[model samples]
Target: MEVNIRHARAGVTIAVDGLAELRELEWHDGHVRIGAGLNLTEIERRLDGRIPLMAEWFPQFASRLIRNSATLGGNIGTASPIGDSPPTLLALDASLILASREGEREVALADFFRGYRQTELRDGELIRAVKIPLPLAPITGFYKYAKRRFDDISSVAVGIALELESDNVRRIRIGLGGVAATPIRALKAEEALAGKPWTKRNVREAARVMGQEGTPLSDHRASADYRAAMLEQALLKFFFEKSEVVRG
Candidate 1:
């Protein structure tokens, strides 16, 4: 649509919707392989709540109409900085299977993007599938802050997955969008929280680190400071929500 609107020229466009290989969903080796051609709507229906973070995210995506036609491959391939899929998938510790005429290679989703709107997808290659390893993080959350509640681009988006040992953080992954040149993992925040008690003081410090994870830029949707503040707030919100769940 962007190409048509801009009257841009293209060499070729290949449609893979009918390709059986690109449309297969398989569960094997303790991981689910999501076919690249599967539409977002189908993915949501098929996965159900198996991937909790995605279940929380799907509705907040563009909308039913847009999701009907949007595929995961297309979403990730575009490498849009504000794209919602990247953060959720990143927190899941997913990988992409890239296929070319020569062969196939798997690349960690974290390492797939090189810059704004740039991906590691080589010429003559396409994302065959996304592989997410099993035994998912027990606690997960997805948050998108936008001007409107629905059908709006995010000002800041966050996806988080965590495993806890008693009250201590066993492992945690935080993925963020709309704050940098590419979707990124909150590694510093994760480091600060890992192996520590999930207490208010520790989380507060980690949240502060999260606020500084990406180089946020001011745009029409929000100010740079607001975006950073939201990053901090999102983590804090997740902790509170989980705490309430435990209390109840």
Candidate 2:
């Protein structure tokens, strides 16, 4: 059943279907409060055309309708290895707000998921909202690849954030989705880019390392080789795209 709470000062809180609970909501800066019940469609539209921080990294998410009802908590709470949000959120260093019925609180983001479809959230504790620090945006983009570009789930997704410092990568962050049991951070790829001169060779080497980081499996949608190649191409394209933006 849907739970609704009427606040004296704040607006009503409606329990979102298919989620844990309607804990709370708040928005500040570029960050928004998301009750577990707040559906994806709502968040996507609200976030639409705004979260360009990882645009060059991975742009293709669910459609408007899908986004409308899909809860933000569902994406993180589902913890699906192939789910779209984790990798980008991981790359962006988002923080999860956990709440207990007793009013206790906890924060987790990095190193939260233990395995596929698993998370660190304690039982009966609900996700209040996630906090994302807005991007500084020197060279940032999201690149996602799949069999069908529009509606199909990704075979591999890359989220790369870079800061160009004097023709070299001063800083970089990479997040990979659908390449492993959980959306993953490509620390190796980031390391390869940092302090290294931006060039085709460096990008290729980083792509190689990223491929190694993936444990892509043969599935109905894709073969292991295709996933690896997709990651390689995605990373390469992201490098060039960001290079252009940062150079400009």
Candidate 3:
């Protein structure tokens, strides 16, 4: 589509769907390696609910038509700040397997994006697969705020993976999109919540830090203030939802 719309130019385009090696999916060394060639639909079916965060993310990404054709490699390759996959993958502490003539190397998703529409991929390197570490977090949530509930781009997207110990936060990872030049982890917020009691006050403080984590810009989709508000609300919402689940 970028080529058709003249947004991207390529002297030649090579089809890679026929590369069987790039379609292999397997679990090894305590991590699941998902082939870069697998489309979102195929990924969802293959993963089932093993990865709870991604299980909740798939349905909210674009539409069925888009999911059927969009591959994980392509999504990560684009390096779009608003791309849905990055945030979720970041929350899961995923990494990319970059392959080239020389050999293959893994790059953490957090370090993959260098800037807006830029990545660490070398000239000859291609993403072969995505590796997600095993033993998923106990509490996970994905929140995408857009003008439309379905089939719309997000103005703010939050992916969270958290572990709680005796009502205190053992660990937490927050991935955010549409609020910076690249998808980023809310490190400061995580620091604020770490080892703190999972109470309204601690969460509220961390929420404030999260809202200020990224450098948001006002765009047609939403105002910068609105994006910040959503970030704050997303964390609070997740906490409330999980609290309700525990109460039940």
**Candidate 1, residue 98: how far the Cα is off, in Å:** 0.4
Expressed as tens digits, the lDDT of each residue in 31-76 for candidate 3 is 9999999989998998888899999999999999999998999988
lDDT of 2 by residue, 1-248 (tens): 02354433436655546544553455677665556666655554456646665343223666666666666677778777777777777767677777777784646566778787778878877777777765454566677677777566877777766667788888777778888888888887788788998888998998888777768899987889988888788788876766657568
TM-score, model 1 to reference: 0.96
RMSD (CA, angstroms), candidate 2 = 7.1
lDDT of 3: 0.92
- Runs of candidate 3 with Cα error greater than 4 angstroms are 4-7, 245-248
Q: Model 2: runs farther than 4 Å from truth?
A: 1-36, 54-59, 104-108
Q: How big is the positional error of residue 81 in model 2, measured in Å on the Cα after superposition?
A: 0.8
- Pairs clashing in candidate 1? none
- Candidates sorted on lDDT, descending: 1, 3, 2
* TM-score on alpha carbons, each prediction: 0.96, 0.81, 0.96
Question: For every candidate structure, what is the RMSD over all alpha carbons to the true structure, in angstroms?
Answer: 1.4, 7.1, 1.3
Off by over 4 Å in 1: 4-6, 246-248
